[model samples]
Target: MATSTFRVNVLLKEGVLDVQGKAIESSLPELGVSSISNVRVGKLIEFSFDHEGSSLTDEEQTKLTKVCHELFSNPVIESYTLTEVK
Candidate 1:
């Protein structure tokens, strides 16, 4: 078995209010970062999995997706993307 690394990117869905993101965005102007806008806060979760191959199998991906949905992110307000890390 090989150990593979993956990343789960969790972010608030569009139309959902991101209070922390808004707070940081509002403060950026005072800190001289005025050109950036539409800032949103999200979390990156890295995990390792031991599997048979270099890439994740379908079953492994399903398991990870389930974990992301059930543990790492909120279904109503957040969306997530899973990627293999090199």
Candidate 2:
């Protein structure tokens, strides 16, 4: 079996109103930081898979997407991207 590492980025969709992101952004000026705008807060998740002498295929990708939607992200307001890291 081969072990592979993957990364998942989960973010709220555009215009979804990230409350945490907004609060942090609003506080930036008080922290003496200006010139920054449109801040976003998202999540990064790293995980691995062990496959039996086979590379990841489309079916595995689909399963990963399903896991993202079902467990890691809120499908109504957030979206996610997956990448296999070298």
Candidate 3:
């Protein structure tokens, strides 16, 4: 069996309200930095799976992506990207 690492990048949808990001944006001017316009926050997740890369097919990858979409991400407010890495 081979083990592969995967990286997941998650971000808020455009026009979504981010309270934390909003707070950061509001505070930037107090710190004497006035060039910033907007801010958004996001999450990054990484994990590994053990499987036979030689045999695991594209269908399996699709299945995994669907599982991620269903279980790991909120479709209403966020989007995610999954990538296989060595």
The number of the candidate with the highest lDDT is: 1
Query: Residue 66 deviation, candidate 2, in Å?
Result: 1.4
TM-score of 1: 0.91
Q: Go through the candidates in order and give each one's C-alpha lDDT.
A: 0.91, 0.88, 0.82
Error of 2 at 82 (Å): 0.3
Tens digit per residue, CA lDDT, model 1, 36-67: 99999999999888888877789987888789
* Candidate closer to the true structure by TM-score (higher is better), 1 or 2: 1
User: Which lDDT value does model 1 have at 66?
Assistant: 87
RMSD of each: 1.2, 1.4, 2.0
Provide the global lDDT of candidate 1 against the true structure. 0.91
Candidate 1 — which residues are off by over 4 angstroms? none
lDDT of 2 at 10: 93
Worst 10 residues of 3 by lDDT: 48-57
Structure candidate 3, residue pairs in collision: none
- Cα deviation at 6, candidate 3, in Å, is 1.3
Worst 10 residues of 1 by lDDT: 47-56
lDDT of 2 by residue, 12-80 (tens): 999898998889888998989998888889999999877666687787767888889999899899989
Model 3 bad stretches (over 4 Å) = 54-56
